[model samples]
Target: MRYGSVCSGIEAASKAWEPIGWKPAWFSEIEPFPSAVLAQHWPEVSNLGDMTKIADAVRAGDVEAPDVLVGGTPCQAFSIAGLREGLSDDRGQLTLSYVELANAIDAKRRERGETEAIIVWENVPGVLSSKDNAFGCFLAGLAGESSELQPAGGKWTHAGCVSGPERVIAWRVLDAQFFGVAQQRRRVFVVASARKGFDPAEILFEQDVGSGSTEANNVGVERRSSTVDNCTLYRFRRTDSYIDDGVSSTLSARDYKDRRELVVMADNRVRTLTPLEYERLQGFPDGHTLIQYGEKLADDAPRYKAIGNSMAVPVMRWIGERIAAALPAEKLSGDYGGSKTPPDQRDLWRTPPALFASLNDEFCFQLDAAAAPHNALCRKFITADQNTLETLWADYLNVPGYVWLNPPYSDITPFVKKASAESRNQIGTVMLVPADTSVGWFREAIETASEVRFITAGRLAFINPVTGKPVSGNNKGSMLIIWHPYPRTHCHFATVERDELMTFGAKLLARREAA
Candidate 1:
């Protein structure tokens, strides 16, 4: 099959389809850096300068119109790094041009005997994420011309504008890591076809996000997901998995900086992969072509830009091949699996440290006595499930012993109520929680615990499931609140700097009440 590629990133489309005997008649890349890599590697291909110029030029070419047009446009303007100007913004508008060009191609194909042609495109995941449907609006604009966008009457926007489906865009957000990319890189796909009813939905899949996929349950908590079947390929292999169950590993940004914070296959001890490895992990073939150009770039530049900018070739090809199969072998047009585009893959939660603890005066009785010798501390070693949080409840307070508590954030209201009820009892409990002081739970924990020891620090120490070692410098800090043995309802107030809080949670645990 012959196709045309524009705004291609590192030629992922070329590599993905080349093995299938797919050939590219022409291609374009405006960026000199990636263009350099493409030229160095695939030197025989012809180049088109810009999408706007090439869109019409290709349409009018003496050669036949491409059955498939593939592009993964640059998305920095809408990325986190910049003000999310979207397609309306100048730099980001290139995406709109792609849609227009594809529409033009579809129209030209329609003028001829051709009834079907497919246009497959990719972009950052942020496109589909917005509640405003900003990206959707762009796709609607692409389906027709400026006329349909601004309908005259109440019909289809513009009364006299170009109407009907000139081109169809069916898209979904996907993570490269899910397709076997080592790092959690997300990209949105916009699959536009001149044919009606073409669907991109069949290729969409899901996998667990975040750390801890080997423990058989939630991270530092009980199992939340249902029975995990091992057969499902989340991304590709060794990709997305839950913290406590599946054998797959989490791909964190820390892998870029910390060598120890990586997943090593026990069989080979492949010390995790370099950023280059991360690229390969994501299905980019020999992106090492860009590596030689690194010396000209800054130290943090190569992997930083390459990984962020790359598309998982396997996932892309999977989507592309699906589109290709849906269409007639020589033509591009099919009904899309009805759906929307996808969003980016940036990490949502940066884990914070455990700060305040709640306890049942009975369960914590031993702990209180340990702080004051009034309660028995020696016999309080209670068996607790590592999956379920260990907590001090009301019944434990009645027992004449010290209480040990490690509670989950869930149902904190009951724990606070139990601790508050023991204002006069000789029991105290400490718990871990986020540092948000304004929350009612913190207020309750502070109001009831006889004495509060607010451990301040920056990053907290965590076990990187990827590395199984202390996520040392990677911690943002956490808290360990130790309530005094005495029974008095008192709440102390203080503030913690991020760095100090990080250190205090991971390295130092001073009583904030001290000074």
Candidate 2:
């Protein structure tokens, strides 16, 4: 299949694409660091220097038109990495380069007798909003002033030469971690193609789904830093999940040399990811990032810059898979062009399975029963993608036999002390807290836990499910604690020592679980 790439990096994608039997017809990239990485990795292809030079290529026709083009455009203008002035911002305007190339490619492809080619566009979720546009008028001329495509699916396609994807563009949000990547990354992708004979419904459904699309509706098409989906995701801020040891992490600027964020649980132990761990989080093949690449940059710069600019490969791979499923076989010719997967007989919009909600309700009901007395319960049944500490807290509380409280190691001393004291001031409870022996919270928990163990290291890790072993060594932060008071003779019924309970200074929140 004909394919082209722009805003290319070290070409981690080359691996994923090569397996699909797709060969790159063009490669475009910029910057010294990434170019070196790309050159070191993909030395064979025609490495076009810059995407901004695309308009010139179309004018000159040096860049041959292709049937399929894929790119994650330079998104600094739309990234949290910089001031997010969407289109108006110079960097955000880079997206227009992709759009310009799309238009140019299509026009030229028609000239070359190619009927329809695929256009895969990926970018930061923020670009979907107009409020972030910066360069304004300059962008008007970039992609021919076409409006942003609707972010729904199953609403556009062809019905046998009946004005197919013709001009209809479709888009959706997707994530990498769920496709088995170690990190949590979300992206938005848009697809546009000439209408020939396809179903708009299937096209819309594809864009509306295929991984990580459950979240678009949660947001109100507004723009205030397209960060997390909503405030429901802010529970990490109010608690200790941020420096989680096993779960891979976000690449923050400060954490470039090393994950500046360390997981410090209740025992004073600390854990954070190494650059190697960061590589795994981004879905690279094991040891894919050369040691020199990671080692050459002092500290975590290699890891930070490499992953920060990279797209969640799994998400894009999923897009490729969806595209593969929707498109006629690459060799489709003669008859299939006018063929139709008609309106009545289609599998694209199958009704969602009833089992997930049915089974999850049972899990929630059982979990809720167990965590009943302890006011900490999770709110609802969230999917695999549902890890917001707030939602988890609300939902966890609903489960039976558990009071899952993971408070931020630094800001949780007072809260932990309260949850601790409220356990009948002596009844047992389990808390997955930071092991920061130095932090007042850990000290408080340590001073009290009838049993405390070094479960694992966090702050950064690959994360083992049963034993909680981190992929990286245990040089970071955090440990788990299980506090159950020993049955001592009646000195004080459910005796809770004031020194141990000393961190308890705030009002305790005693609310019933949400039924």
Candidate 3:
């Protein structure tokens, strides 16, 4: 298989897929250091220079159509570390360029009567929150839907088709640690196949991929960051200030200097990760970036930047393998089936079991029932479809029962609004939601909720009601928003340590059984 990469930082994709019978066609990188690294390592392959010109090049026949196209586009514009400008930012615009290039590549191949190239993309999860629904626009573009980032520019469609969903696309937030990488890096990977009806989720969403409780592959005794600060750095945003688990927090290019999310090691004496260690964390060889690329780039900062910006090698390798396994074939438009899994094959996708229970108490009313209504812990339960907001104001207001909500993540505004209202009106409530303090609902919760308990366990593997299995992972951190009844608010807003919720679930289960 032949592949080309865009925004190719140190060519992690090449390193990953080359070992598994994949050859490099070209690399599109603008940064001098990374471009040099690519030129040095893979001298035989061409450097496509800027991504903006890739489509034009392909159309001009200057570049051959690759079998696969992979890239991790610039993420800062959408990252929390930045202003979150998203697609509006210059860097974020490159994401669209990626899509355009893929469309052009696929079209070029089709003209030659060859198989269309598969497209793989990676980005920070923050892209999901791009301004003016940019994420939705990008998805619509990938799925062969006629859409544009701006409505004023008329309809946008992928090349070569009048467009009736000609491509199959799927996306999921995947953690690198799950794919055998030690670093706890969570990224959103989107895969698109030119072969209509091919589901990318089938290749990307396998369960039980994480190394549960396993220590990261220790490179050597010298695997530590370069930061010399004596102050202990903690995970300041959601959880405590120190790393409890061996998994390193998401490795950013400026993590050593920014010190915003990460801190010095938990121990006062432990140092920051070395440049080589950063490479190791991303599943690259020890000296992958340390090599002589052109003028011998020896600076550790450049190495760190390149490594942090690249896709995790192991994660990409797994994706490549899956793609390879399903290759040498394509079905006609109507011949391909839907993306849903068959009942017989459901076991392959079921998440592993974890500790969780529905608690029944005088103060508890499970609003969103994972199971049947009556099966919930409370005397009253609300099904997912039920509008708990209107009900809370009409019937449940002034009722003393504590509200337990595990609402759907798509839109948590209504749920948060209702929960906050109930809590203000003497009804206690607790919500289990992602630990995203940047959202509007979170701010609303802070105004009313007594505590925003960042779950120390990180992502909670909520059990799937149908199969009685735990979800693979939420792909992000979770938190509990506890709001006590008014006139009893001494500690209005506080952080609950990780251990507080460890036995909390068990005790609630026992209480329900006794009641």
Candidate 4:
């Protein structure tokens, strides 16, 4: 199979697919260092330079379209690290360019009566939340329906959208560690094919296939790291589990400057990975991105940037192998069972220290504490073991004081209802729950609570009870629902973003603390 790769940082797609007899026909890149890396290795392949011109180049006969189009576009636009602008930012518009180019390729294939090319794309999980259901529209576009995107240019034109029965599209969040990489990198991979009898879901979603499969029901297996014989294997972060086995944390370009990001033991001595080690973690050849421009490029920052940005070679290879086998193979599309709707981001179970400190008060009663004490402010606590649901309604509905309620994630309606009722009784209560707008309880809290503060610090990282460490992080946004018994003069209910939430919560907590 041949490939035309976009946003081709060091051409990870080429390295990944090469072993399976896949070849790169062209690469799209602009960065100097990564472009040099591509020139050093896949020098024969044409460097297309810019992804925005792919469709035009193909149409103008300046470049030949390949059987496969693969790319991990710039993730910053949708990354939580930046303001998730989705298609609004100029960088975000590149995603639209990708879709447009693929549409153009499909259009050409139709004109020539040729098989439509396969499309594989990758991005951070934040894309799942960007621009209010943008992923849903992305799914629609791949299925040959209109994407309903704005700016007119990003729209899926009927001519570009394929309408036949042969099309199949699927997406899933896959971890790199599961695919034989020794790093805990989780990314969203989307696969689509406009060919008949080919199910992209079957290729991308199936688990424990072929020989020597390590697949299991254990999710902890992904986090499990094994120590190398004489080398110091390391895990970073006080919040992460201290495992006997050595598994490396996810590598980011920014980790070079952050000691906490790359804490490691080499031969029992603490050190960070050399550029070569970083390359190997991503399944790249040693010095693939480095040593390209000789001493001029010897600096590690560019190497780290290139390596971190590239896709995991082994993960892509696994996907490529499946694509190869499934080309002529038969599999039912829907039987594989993947979600068309992106999964909701996981919620942080424990509130962060700063957050807890910012919201604490005197005489606070925790209505829904678990066996594990997650909140420090709760002087009087009700545990799940004590049938807290029954207790909340019958025993303590009118109990006065600053009440902190981090109720059970499931079945929050009754608790929300109780809190709403008790607010009328002049009991001040604050509840933390997922900001899932679809749920009835979420709506109930918003409608009934005196004020709702949407946490804009993105997501909270919760502490793990079993490991006594912090879990990596949860993507699900949280909301603080406040029900003050005394009516406020400013407004009945106001929604505040991160800064406002932090500022307001901190002032209140500080006042109580000072007193």
Candidate 5:
């Protein structure tokens, strides 16, 4: 298969896929050092300077539309170490340009009576929770949705799949250490295909259910140490440094000077890793970046930056092998059935009546802070048209009572912030959300909440808006976060069973109705 690559730093994809008989049609890179590296390695392929113009060129019949398109756009805007400005930053805007290029390639290929181009995109995990919802915008563009696609829960899980009218897209977070690399680099990879009966999930997710092993492969290398007077002193460093247990921390472009990991040898001497070592960590050949420029050999500064900004070779090779195997196969059966609701409305599934009845009895909720007329659990509630984020909770509740919120899962940052502010207004607030403790918004909720209760028995079966029946196969666990006006020394933690809650709630409702 021939492929076009954008933001191609040193052409890691080509290096990885070459053994699988995949060729590079062209490369899009503007950086002088990396451009030189690409030219040195693959002199026959052209290097398109800017990515913003590639889409137009393909549409105008100036460039060849390959079978696949791969890129890892600038990720600083969404990186945790950076400012986190998201799509507002000029670099972050390249992500949308990538979508445009993909569309153009697919359109051109269809004109030539060829299958649509497969797309592979890579980025830091921070893009999943960008304040501007950058990931939603990217996914919508690829899937041909009119609006941004919201995640099922308030936050995106480590992996998921979405099938739209145009394509089937799947994403997963993969760590480099698990892919034969000695560095702990976690990246998000998205694979999409417009081919009939082709499921991207089959490429990204393993179908083997019986192999439950989670241990890393043993390299069979002994630890570096020195023996003095029959006493061995193993080499080690402090946790502040990135080196620990023979694994290196993530390599970043800024590691040339700052954030570099240091190693303390058995002799008690300290030193930093060299540029050649950086290449080895990323699975690159030795001196891959050592090229002859205008006058002489390139220096170490640019080599360090180029190697640090590259994709791990071993990880890319695995993905290429999977794609190669599925490229020529017959149409597969059991394709993902499209969602029942539009991408924007999929999060509107209502809370189960029994679960709400059980919680309302204990909290005495008077206002449903986030709900529509049909799904509201309380008599007094606010609807989406009323702008719950801007509406005051006290206005909905005349007396002292709790407010219940099961907010939209697409962008929960605003809802979380609003909920925290409401808790400070002498109003009790109880929020039901996915039990995702790793996100930043969850941390904010925990800091302000008076209590947290995790549902332990099983996942909750939410009520389907269309069927009016419980929806099974819920993937994530649920939790209730409470912020009450009453003073407490510390936040209380507890667990409850779903079966018990539903059973008790049904009996209580029946007795009250008989009275």
Candidate 6:
């Protein structure tokens, strides 16, 4: 397949898809460093520079109408770290331009009696919940909807599919760590096709067959030096530090100078990740960003930024393969059997330490009912191996302190029923779950719980069980379901700011540590 990429930071799509017989029609990157890197590597391919002009250029036949249109438009406006001006921001406007480019490519192809180009887009998961409905607008434009599509339950899920007048669209939030990268980088990927009988879901969703081991299809699996003390200390702090086990956090474009965002502690020394390590972490070859620009060697700052901004090569490679498998003539028939299953349903999203600390202080949580050894927030906890659902909570929490439960997203009904039952037996419980008010279980919680706290500051960035890093840009809003030992006559409802809780919790933990 020949593809055109826009906002092509270092052309990660080209690098990932090239090995599988896919070719690049052209690239649209304006950054000096990344543009130079593209020229140095693939000099023959033209750099279209400004993406806003690509639609006009393609319409004028100045550029090839590729078989596929792939791009990860500027996400800052939609990123939680940014001002989040959404479509009002100039950068966020590029998302619309991307749709125009896709339409232009398909228009040119249609004139030639060819099939419509497949559209692949990637962005921070924050886009799904943008206040301006940025994702809904983009999807509407791509799907040819007469009006903007609203997410069910007023929030987008991690995965879903939609069919519209123009195209069939499927989207899912994928984590780089699952694709063989060590970083806990979670980003939303959307695939759309206008072809008749084509199901975009086939390209993005995978069947849960086999042993569920990703080893067989691991990509760019590079070996790194063992941890200095048998455990790598991954720390992220606002003013204080907390240690956790696992891989690195998401590498950001500003990570080069943002020491507090991610810190590596080894052998009693603290330091920042090197540029070369950034490249490797993104599944690029060592020194992939250390390219020759005009005369002098490229500086470390630009290299760090470029690599950090790029997508994880392995994850992109997997997507490319899936797309290829769904191409014309080679498309597989019959249901994949797992397309509708939420991709993150089984993931162990540990509660953020600061938030947990604050809640623990308020409730004196003595038992972590749903936890693994690596992500347990309390000294006393039950593991998956123990079958928390099958086992009695009274057996674990003999004393009668509050219980904290962040159950698997796959199914929260059983846990809710259990919590309600436990509460009736004089056990208090606090459960963190998606605020999906439409569900029966959610209504049940409202009726049975003493209080329901809707986390309104923002979507809580839950910690990844494997990486020990907080996965930001959570797609849905969260809420705390509190059940007191004695049921209240009426349930109290309140809104809490996650940032405030986190800050207060962090300071409390810091004072405790100092003491």
Error of 4 at 157 (Å): 27
Query: Across residues 1-515, which tens digit of lDDT does each residue of candidate 2 receive?
Result: 54778887755556666656566666888766667666666675667887888756754455656557788776677666556666666666677677677777776555433455677766666555435343222223322454433323423222111212234455555655455554556666666666465433354353443333333432332211212121111112325555332334455434664454444434655555555555555666655455344446334565467656777655566556556667665332211121122322211111111211222232222222112222224442223234323233333442123343443222455545644553433334454443445445555665556555443312222222223332221112334455443332222112222222212211121111222
Which digits, one per residue and each the tens of the lDDT, describe model 6 over residues 262-378? 444545555666787677668887777888876888988888788878898877898888878776443222211111112443346678889998998899888899887877888
Candidate 4 residue runs with Cα over 4 Å from true position:
147-166, 207-229, 238-245, 263-267, 294-297, 329-515
Clashes of 5: 0
Per-residue lDDT of candidate 5, residues 66-173 (tens digit): 888999999998887768889899898999999999998888666544578899999999999988888998899899999999987778887899988778999988
Q: Compose the digit string of candidate 1's lDDT tens values, residues 1-515.
A: 55778876567788788766566766777776667667666776666657678656545532335667788766655665445766666767777777767766655454432445576777666655433345555666766644424323422210011223555445555554444343445566666655555544433321343432222222354322211122221222334333322222333333345433234343534343445554565566544545456456324444545454666677767766665566533311211111011111011111333221122312323432111122112243333232112344334445333444433333345545654554335454554444445456666666656544443533343333233333332211234444544644455554454454444443323443354
RMSD of 3: 23.5
The residue-by-residue lDDT of candidate 3 on 49-132, one tens digit each, is 888998987765556567789998888888877688888889878878888888888776655444577888888887776665
Off by over 4 Å in 2: 130-166, 198-246, 252-254, 261-269, 291-300, 330-515
Q: Which window of ten consecutive residues has the lowest lDDT sum in model 5?
A: 332-341
User: Backbone clash tally for model 3?
Assistant: 9
For TM-score, the strongest prediction is 6
CA lDDT, every model vs. true structure: 0.48, 0.47, 0.64, 0.65, 0.78, 0.78
State model 5's lDDT: 0.78
State the TM-score for model 3. Answer: 0.54
Candidate 6 matches the true fold with a TM-score of 0.60
Evaluated at residue 256, the lDDT of candidate 1 is 49
How do the residues 124-203 of candidate 4 rate in per-residue lDDT, one tens digit apiece?
Answer: 87777676555555666666565543323543221122232435767777777776667778788888888767777777
